[model samples]
Target: MSAMVDTPAAQPLPRRTEGSSARIGALAPLSSPGWVEAGRHLLAGLESGVLDVNDAGGVLGRPLELVVRDTAADPQRAAAAVEELAGLGVAAVAGEYHSVVARAAAAKADALGLPFLCSSAVLDALTDRPTDWVARLAPAQSHGWRIYAEFLLGAGHRRIAVAAQPSVYWESGTRILREHLAPRCGTVIELDMGALTPEDVCDALADHGATALLLLTGIPEPAVSLVRSVRADRRLAGVLVGAPAGQPEFGPWAALLGEDGAGIPFLRYLPERLGPLGARVGSALRERLGRAPSFVAFEGYDTITVLADVLSAGELSRERIPASWAGVAVEGTRGPIRFSRVPGVGVRQWAWAPVQVVDRDPAALDRFRVLRTG
Candidate 1:
């Protein structure tokens, strides 16, 4: 349980090889403050049988055994974790929560002929590379931006700008926004976070003639800055700022924004059903993280759900897996997830990405006063 443990002995999963059992691994980052809490909810689901592999006693001859590894937010460590899962005879691994880690672990999965289904990672480089041994249940970064772009167009904003730091997410934000805007918009700009002030932001806004902004940053600190700057100048007070992360805190900033941030919108993709199992996992997430985790946990939770159905169909054999996994739709928290096989990748399904308008109440200051439940 310590941070510095070596590649320990192959401690077999409890019910494995005893009869019929499939091995599934969750490659998680206990180090990430946001995602690790999500992992805990997923763990609770796995432990409680909310994600039942038995599938009403008709899917497979075996139940699933979940193995877990802490990537600790290190990419090399993530790769090593995949190798360990391969050695443990795990049939598949959930690549870590970031694209770099997913890409690293994917190489091992491809070489060893194991399936690596992505959960939370959203780097575009992930899908750009063609591989059969890897596929993701979650949307690629491009998909995320695509959803955000559609949201913008629907809201009638043509000029777009991104406020961001130069991290991996920012790099992805630049690429996705460029692709989404180039074909359809008249003006697009990206403001770097190297250092910024109200005047600098206003100057950028003026250059683009922006009526709306797409805040690439997850939090609205940059959006707040924009509001303060625009308000002081009085000319730009009504400009809109929207967030894709759907964070609630953007609510209070609306007051500073006048009308810009209050009714301002956000985006998310979610499951369509409650099934027999969802609440169990959702509650576990709340217990562990003190709040509901995001689509990331749903991705991890759904990975198990699909595998459970597949394993419940027959004995744990590679040949039997294809029939079980192919094109099967999982009614997960993120709606329906299906899989397709690429030449080098094992089996992966294209995900349906959706965008919705989240109403934030400034009176409540970003708390979920009422969830529209799209």
Candidate 2:
């Protein structure tokens, strides 16, 4: 972990007249195949924070409510959701997972002059533009890829092969890995997994003498197939396999991949070890939802906490929210959360967010272990 930097605190702004409710909009893929459970976790965090605030006399002495909109993992639907949320008079908007949907929502939120706090979208390009109203809770793809590169180098993997799906999220991460790891490694082979079969991937790994394979696809079918193919081939048995941040959550990947999912490392927001605050939040979530909190839940809870802090300390209106966030810092489940305006990346991004490499224990697939942190 890095030392926390001190940033200026938000200045108090004039309070608005008392209202019955302070509503914030939440957008998530509640209908998408792999994202429905993630959306539930996000909602759990948002609702938990809202309930806590209401118990503590709420923001501006009014109850805070969440207006959730399902994006269906579609860009067009996400943009439309932004319009609906804004028309409903939400003070700000938060929550999203898919990068495509988040990018569309961020643009719409900017057009509507609403503060949009991205929860888990990690594509670098989402925040690679000049949008003051947009801020991300998740670490950018570059941050995670840097950690992946270091892990590979530390493991003495000189010849690295990357298998990726041709999505915006995977493309951004692949580019980062190529730029950072190419010079360090003996050779870097990039393959489009969408056009290749499992046998084709195995053949490339063997042909290139790859010591490590990085799978950058978020979809489970390809990831599972590739892992199975890698495991089945004794010739490639020495090759270490991993994913970026695309593996499925809450044990589905484990169940689907069976023994194949074991020992496959990937970058994730939450570590296997929880801090005091993380443990408390996890306990609360489990008790309320009857399941452990997922990484997305932690992000959702933290996003609302940051928003509430800004809204309570500064002006309650949307106009001052961006300025309020400029200097604000709050403790989240992961660590201290703050925003920065990177030159080329998105403006107001939570640049210092933590990421870790996690893998399922081969003997116990249900157990996940944190291998490295950054």
Candidate 3:
């Protein structure tokens, strides 16, 4: 079950409905071409205890139910899904994947005064939203880049090399780099690999070498192309360090990079640190889906955990939820997660999990240890 949608999709504008209830909905590309696998994982997580819905803070005395609808990755369809959920009288929504879709969905959720928890959308667009009802669980990619820059600069490396895939995430990373490096008294050379072919990406990597390299982009295909190509370069053999893509999609690349990727830092919440309950979640997902869970599973899990915590505090209302979320923090598979009221986006801090490449399992890692590498 790959998590992808139909080819040549379009916008899905969603509308709100009157009245609100305790029902919570998950809007995503469940029926999309490759999404069945991820959708099943999400469903499995919800069915088991991973994304278990709290009984409206356990105050309502009735177990909460999660209603999911497939957006097919179409923006208009995504809007329709939210309209339907809003019509269902849902109090909140927990969704997975894509910052673009999340932005549309979050807009709908906010109009209805329903709480929106973004499990996978990392685009600053999603986080930069000003809605009080919206909160992003993932740390800002900029924060991760800033952390990476600090570490690389402090190591006494004057010139730095960076590679990006021209994604919005990569663009934001580049922006952060310029801002951070410009002010930090450090110099850097960024390798813009956007629109570059696999061979071109590799050549770019081989061409540049000064300090640590920051490969910014989560697109697994091209990232794999470049990582393998550059690691093979004999001249650049002993490059100091590299930061994995900020998003977990780079898990596959981690395995490809092997030893050099050993000290590669990424943002993730390892299953081990999630404790007894988190492991149970991993087992539950594997049992149902028959494949190990990754960031996708953890994302859904974190969203529910956070919403449940907020609900448990008191009645989940528009104003109250954000108020409580102001100082709230939850340890998720990604890292210590929290959000602050950033004028545009409701909450601002994204967590980082510095994982070292142990062996073949870039997908599976040593414990998610938080080190100040970025």
TM-score per prediction, in order, is 0.72, 0.90, 0.70
> Judged by lDDT, which candidate is best?
2
Candidate 2 structure quality by residue, lDDT tens digits, 28-141? 888855367777888888888788778888887878889998988889999998888887778889998888789999877776677889998877777334766778888877
Q: Please give the RMSD to the true structure for each candidate, in Å.
A: 7.2, 4.8, 7.8
In model 2, the worst 10-residue window by lDDT is 1-10
- Model 3 TM-score (2 dp): 0.70
Q: What is candidate 1's lDDT per residue for 1-374, written digit by digit as tens?
A: 11112212222333444455566777876665324544454455444343344554523545566788887667788878888887787866764665666777876665555667676666656633455456666556666666667666766777877666667766766777678867885456777756766578777877677887656553346656655566566555556666664543322344455444555566545543444556666676556546565545556667777666555553554334545556466676545667654332233545453434464555653443322333
Tell me how candidate 1 scores on lDDT. 0.59
Model 2 residue pairs with clashes: 127-346, 128-346
Highest-scoring model, TM-score? 2
Question: Which candidate model has the greater lDDT, 1 or 2?
Answer: 2
Q: What overall lDDT, based on C-alpha atoms, would model 2 receive against the true structure?
A: 0.79
- lDDT of candidate 3 over 1-374, digit per residue (tens): 11112212212213333333346688666765424445555555554532355422332443566788876656677766777776666657777565567777877776666667776666666633355567776555555456666765666655666777655656766677778887666666666666566566445545664655666654354555555666676666656545544433333444555444544555443433456666766776667666677656766776777776676564644345645565667665445666654433443334443332212333545323444432
- Cα error of candidate 3 at position 370, Å: 7.0
